[model samples]
Target: MASTDSHSCVVYLVDPQDGKKGTVVPDRFRRLAIADGCGVVGLESADEDGGSQEELTGLIVAAIAAVMERQDPAELGGDGRAKVGAVAKQAGFKVTKVQFDEAWPKYVDGLGADDEDKDGE
Candidate 1:
């Protein structure tokens, strides 16, 4: 999601069940998360830029986890989104929600392409 002013983009990795918030990490650590649940991660572009989308996503997720781990548990309570936002802001990215209406077509196209690839195989 790009900020209203177009300065930054936000990606939300919210939990579908209880709206638990997080981001995408590496395969090895994501496997661990399957059992332990995802921890929050936020990354700023200034710290380091990844060469690929996968690398950048992994960095964002790891940073969120690191920031959350340092916070006081009692302060976090049930307000996971707030905590995630705080971390993201501190990292220098402005938070903004992406509109589902605008985003859905890209997802559908991607999924369709994936299906076509499988059919070809």
Candidate 2:
């Protein structure tokens, strides 16, 4: 296993059955996460020039736990779309329902992908 080095990585410590909320994972401990049940988005490791290295592209954005949920697109109409879209749109693409639906589960590094296909829920 690789140690948590200068290059950061988000570690979402999540519990799907729990409430939905996020918490920060410090840079030093960011690279550390244990789960087939969490979402991790990488940020760029800032450099002296206010940018990061080309080689070190992904930095730890956040580390959350016991809170990641498999978001359903139908639930977007109420209010959550804005929150999810912020991240999806940041990728520099037009945010659409189809795209968001596909991307939501992957955000958790396949945590939601497992049982969804098997249980037919």
What TM-score goes with each of the models? 0.28, 0.23
Give the C-alpha miss distance for residue 119 in model 1, angstroms. 41
| Clash tally for model 2 | 12
Model 2 over residues 53-116: C-alpha lDDT tens digits? Answer: 2211121111111112335454234644324344333332233455445444445554456558
**For candidate 1, lDDT tens digit of each residue in 4-93?**
345432234784555756655554343234223333355333333222333423434444545555685632438442254543453334
For model 1, the stretches where C-alpha displacement exceeds 4 angstroms are 1-51, 73-82, 95-121
Q: What is the C-alpha RMSD of each candidate to the true structure, in Å?
A: 18.5, 15.8
lDDT at position 116, candidate 1: 98
Q: What is the lDDT of candidate 2?
A: 0.36
